[model samples]
Target: MSESHQDKQHKARQQKVKQQVDARIANATEEKGLLLVITGNGKGKSTSGFGTVTRAVGHGQQCGVAQFIKGTWENGERNVLEKLGVEFHVMATGFTWETQDKQADTEAAQALWQECKRMLSDASLDLVLFDELTYMVTFGYIELAEVIDALNHRPAHQSVIITGRGAHRQLVELADTVSEVRNVKHAFDAGIKARKGIDW
Candidate 1:
């Protein structure tokens, strides 16, 4: 059998792409901590952050997490990660709407912020995930300047992941990488309730 013209063209295109990728790999030599901000109206923000934490753990890296607005509901990620020596500090105050207590929510946010600061400063922690942190800032429970300052002063080799609905512009501007998840469609809108293992 002989190769088709389409196959030939495909191979040529792939060869060119390979050359470009190789060149990029050769030129990229810098390695440092990365600040990744995942935010938007869609779901999976926390899931994405947890996936990265799992990756870091697989690589034998130290990881920590701060859940700024999570409720007392069971968290599968925390259950698994905690056994892997990943420290977690959760607000456990549920949603602001449910709590409906500004004073209590603010207190919880401040406490979590302090823990996040400690995690950022710890050189031993290679990766830290601030889950739902944007809510704290947006709700006026935490100071944006203080958050930025702590992030700026974090260990040079410590990477951080912040996940929430609405990320501040300042935080996005400072982030090395930012991903915004848009809500195109969701089952919940169709009267589907969040399942225990899947949704939570």
Candidate 2:
């Protein structure tokens, strides 16, 4: 066969495969919820978590958010999500590095984790966002076993989203879908601060 003919045939075969995959996805049931983990050294882990929250709210699903290790300022995402009737819980102690106290950070993280636990068990909540929760496990602030237990015991139809850098391998393995956002470029490196509505 000529090279051009082979290329055309390959393209046609690829299109057929794509169509099959798309059809399968389109017909798939949306009722079965899954645990999702968004992790990596790159930015946007929390951003992705909030994006999922927005999607859930847009679908008229009740959502809950527990923010760990971030409480310095009023983030736009938090404001918008709260306005959408999302039950938001923030540590109010800021980042661990800024607190400069391991015990204090641990206590704060534990409190937030407690709230997350409650949300996980609430069947009425369709989605729960564990924003920056990986830090709790990474820093040994919250017990990994407890976290796993809560995840496993969550409402069957509840969709959970965990986001942060350096997520535990066990958590990633437990997740039904894992997405790692890689940082190709960031404005912070160029001395550009995080902007409202975009970075916050």
Candidate 3:
């Protein structure tokens, strides 16, 4: 009832939380690279992957990114990462909605998959970002088994981040950390078109 009483309760709760968190942190002794999957219908999947890439670059770690879908539109993250000496690769085009020519898309995705394999095998890289990789496998552009094999065989110290919607069940299960960004509401839902600098 009194303000002092409320303050005492809050402090007690804070202390309890601190103790729990500290205990968990102390128990986490094993250190190794992680396989992280960011998937869902939400818009921040690629953003989150790129954000991690920026963090890796900030740590002066070798990093590589293979953009499987996004077109040649100017990318701020790629520009900054490349400036920071990150190895970045982008395909020739983004996914196109069409009635025919699925073969072209598959071929392009296969090419990117090869690049992804190279990046995965590079022992020098501390982190690798496979942007829109889920779509590649889910859409049958690349073999899911091949993707999983590469990821599983990557260097023990190499961390990876996958971003896209509809991530394969096997990939999600293989990931040490998996986050599904839910879309409660989006600007596109509100009829607002994507804008540069904000969307990109």
Candidate 4:
């Protein structure tokens, strides 16, 4: 069979893209720890962070996770990652609206932030994930300045991932890579309850 004109055009476009990508790759030489932020009103923010932690673990790198605003429910990631030596700290207070206790939520956030600080300071850990941390900062439970300071002082080789909706502007600005997961459509909006293994 003979090649079509459309096939030739596609090949030419791909060749051009390859050259552009190759040039960018050649120009990039620096290597260091990165701060990544995953924020928006969509689902899967924490899931994405956990996926990154899993990737690091696969590489035999030490990782830590601090989950804020999450209820004291069973966590599949914690169960698997802990066995791989990843330290995890859960707020265990659930959502703020559910608890409806400002004082207690603040107290829990502070305690969890302290644990996060320890993880950030640990040079042995290659990656640290702060899941749903934006709520704490926005709710005034944790100082944004303190979070920024801790991130700034973290070891040069330690990468960090922050996942939550409504991330602080300052935090977004500081992040090397920022991704916003927009909610186009969700099963919950259609009256579908969140499943255990899939949703959690």
Pairwise lDDT winner, candidates 1 and 3: 1
Error of 3 at 74 (Å): 1.4
Across residues 38-76, which tens digit of lDDT does each residue of candidate 3 receive? Answer: 999988999999999998888889999999878878898
* Candidate 1 lDDT over residue span 1-200, tens digit each: 89999999999999999999999999989898999999999989999999999999999999999998889999999889999999999999998889899999999899888999999999999999999999889989999999999999999999999999989999999999999999999999999999887888
The C-alpha local distance difference test score for the whole of candidate 3 amounts to: 0.89
Looking at candidate 4, what is the lDDT of residue 96? 89
TM-score, ranked from best to worst: 1, 4, 3, 2
Which pairs in model 2 have colliding backbones?
none
TM-score (all chains, Cα) for each model? 0.97, 0.89, 0.94, 0.95
After superposition, which runs of candidate 4 have C-alpha atoms over 4 Å from their true positions? 1-5
CA RMSD of all predictions: 1.0, 3.3, 2.2, 1.3
Top-scoring candidate (TM-score):
1
lDDT of 2: 0.90
Off by over 4 Å in 3: 1-3, 98-100
- Model 1 CA deviation exceeding 4 Å by range: none
Clashes of each: 0, 0, 0, 0
lDDT of 4 by residue, 6-110 (tens): 999999999999999999999999889999999999989999999999999999999999999889788999989999999999999888899999999999999
